[model samples]
Target: MWGTSRWVRRMAQGLVLIASAGLAGAALAGPTLTIGAIVPQSWPSTAEGEELVLGMQLAIKTWPGQPAPTLVIKDSACDPRKAENAARELVAAKVDLVLGSWCAIGIAPRVVAEAGLPFVSANAERLPKAPDGVLQLGRIELYIVEKLAADLRAATGLRVGGRTSCWMNFEPVLREQYDAVLCPVLGFDKKRWEQAEATFTAAHRRPFTASVARGYAAMEAGLAQLRRIRGGKSASNDPIMTIFGPLPPTDVPAQADAMQLVLSPKLPKLSPRDQAAVTQLLQTKACTCLADNSCSKPGPWADQPFVVRGNVPKCPTLAAASPR
Candidate 1:
């Protein structure tokens, strides 16, 4: 949160488009379908966001036939104002559709609403209702919920650990939805993520008041309290994992840091189900959401599982994976 004047100026100026906004991948043969993607290219704190972009780039390269469509990678920098600017640029470029918004707060729909193009997300919280031509690859939050739910169902035949056994950072904007919708769906009765969303449509209110470190501290503290109250252990009693939304994918540093954070000394192995799903994706270079979308040939491997771990936040050009 800079200043009102700076924020207004940024809203108009757009992100620092340091990387050349070029067409990704080798020149393909077809009519060259064009899709715009806004990624968090410069941030250092968003991991889920980076992973998602990898999913999208993989889709465009391997799915849209051998000759992949031209993907214009723009740096939204995970900022709403920059996102708005990116949307305008995409519309101006006349892309067939917008791949999706980089950050959850960045409503890509609002940006390119007039463009008459589909706003699709390989990953994102499915808008309660699809906004006009918008389509999320999968219900974003559901990924975590589904992953945890399946595990829970196996552990306990019940829906949500038989009661409130967990807590999470709840987005204030989506508080009603969580209290009324998601938590109930997950079977969480009392314990839940205590974090709040970070924005406001009404303008008078601000989102969260702490920085990333502070927020994480708060989230961790609440989670510890919930775990203690719920009488849970790390592996056996506390078998359930927490659900955080996709980090800013467009941001490479964020993704890399996230990878280290989530996959290091603590828990790094994917379950058999997850391993299979990821392997299937890499083998076919295809997407679970659509047959038409796939990754580059001989794409990510079980061990490797990704490409371009930096600011780009994606599996790089097929060329990058296997330099031509």
Candidate 2:
């Protein structure tokens, strides 16, 4: 009877030891990092926001790190109030880092910074000046507009009017008035962009946009910084400061057909000289300055412009009367 009791006790002790060992192994494995994302999931910028989230997810999946990070997404709905609330929620949840607040740049960055967290803005109309920890990944809207205007004027000698907002609603009308319309596109490696587009399309059954590319790049930049921090290679205490350094310019020769140009149906026939001028305008490179203020340099797709023509079904009534 005593032998039976001893055997049972030994079995219980062995089970406890096994469980303890399993827990110790888990402890050594460590928890995956949590990244907070605040993006619009409602009206206004819903499509762009969804693409941004998809891009971030793709970045996380493709990371070659030992333990991949996870995302905790909160919908900003493109509203300032909602974005502020979302920032608070992310802070409360103790996310290691924050990325986004696309349209709500006014409020979200401040809120996240106040909570002592790093904020990376993927898309903003203008760079936020007040927030100390904020880092912008995308180019400034006004700068792109100005660059396009200057390039067009220099190349075609045409007057260019700048519009900051309502691009989708007013583009058709604007295109009718203007000779050409230029927009900013994230400059990514051609092969890499193609691969990313394929992956995105395969998963979502639709094509991605500039917003998606921005989100992916922002996530990638953030992850790269995180890796540096983990490896004790980060130079600055602020991750934003460390990662905002100027990137080296690429030596890849510009491809002639790399520019995205769509000729407008309403466009009048151009002379050979005019056509050459337009081509020259399309090949002009734009400079993107780093957030660190270290350098102003063109990206890999510097010479490749993103030009879109007005998709108006019919030319304006006055267009017929006007001479080229």
Candidate 3:
């Protein structure tokens, strides 16, 4: 009876040790996801760079369990060569995924695809097909084209054929399908785009434009994908599909015909306060200095009042817009 009792005690101890070891292993096996980003950190797009970083940082912090990703960011300076080099560095760092440039994205795709890394572009105008390993998260082509076409018909009651408009900015293949009247331009509905831009700028207190908004939207899309990644699955496992849902629309100011103007529905929504701010901003007259002057040089628009001609002060616009 004594021997049997001693043996039973030894067995219990062994089980306890085994269980402790298993727990320790599980604790040490925490997931570590690494993500890399490339942006124009130098002159021309510095505000954009800051906004992009803020968006990604916000997304990561709000994720549950504080599953922080190791972020490696590089400056593209809005240059294709610089973007390519930055991508190569990210690939070398062995990041699981990549978020890339607003300006240089057109050229950066080839580098990302060669590295077999999954990527999201913050401001790509054109969409990409599968197996390309890249996704355009904001300001996508199809949505903009359709919306522009609809707006034109409403404005002119006729489609402008073979006309060099905003449609000209799109690829030849895409433009061919829209041989109608008055294709939308980049700021197709300038009045509406300005309103949306002002609203977003006021809300964020940063210089917001369509491209910057696209950068923010791209980060949101990336965060959504990161949330869906199952544990231990390869990050390369899925293709980034376009989220085709409409975000809440920002209202365009009243027009001659009361035609409702809005930014592309492809964009994500801004808050209610932001929408109101945009409405207020649209009431003000355009500032000649803000519109024509370059912010690249100091004191260009420094003396201008914050509330220009009854419009609430938002961030000033860039001198010359960067070409993506």
Instruction: Assess each prediction's global lDDT (C-alpha) against the native.
Output: 0.38, 0.58, 0.49
Worst 10 residues of 1 by lDDT: 256-265
Best by lDDT: 2
TM-score-superior candidate, 2 or 3: 2
* Model 2 C-alpha lDDT per residue in residues 228-316, reported as the tens digit of each score: 65666655544332111222112222232222233444555666776666433333332122344322333333444343333433221
**Per-prediction TM-score:** 0.34, 0.57, 0.48
Model 3 TM-score on a 0 to 1 scale: 0.48
Q: Give the per-residue lDDT digits (tens) of candidate 3, residues 69-156.
A: 7777888877878888888888898887788756555567667768877687755344434235565543334234355445434433
Q: Model 2 scores what on Cα lDDT?
A: 0.58
Each candidate's number of clashing pairs is 27, 0, 6
Encode model 1's per-residue lDDT on 1-324: one tens digit a residue. Answer: 569989988766653332222223332233556667776666533543344344344334324254455667777666778877887899999976665453433566766655666564433334444555454322233234344435433532322221121111121122211211122111111222232222111222533221221222222222332233234442233322222332222212211111100011112255786555433433332222233344434433322212211111232212111101
Off by over 4 Å in 2: 1-29, 124-132, 141-182, 236-324
lDDT of 3 at 93: 89
Best by TM-score: 2
Q: lDDT rank, highest first?
A: 2, 3, 1
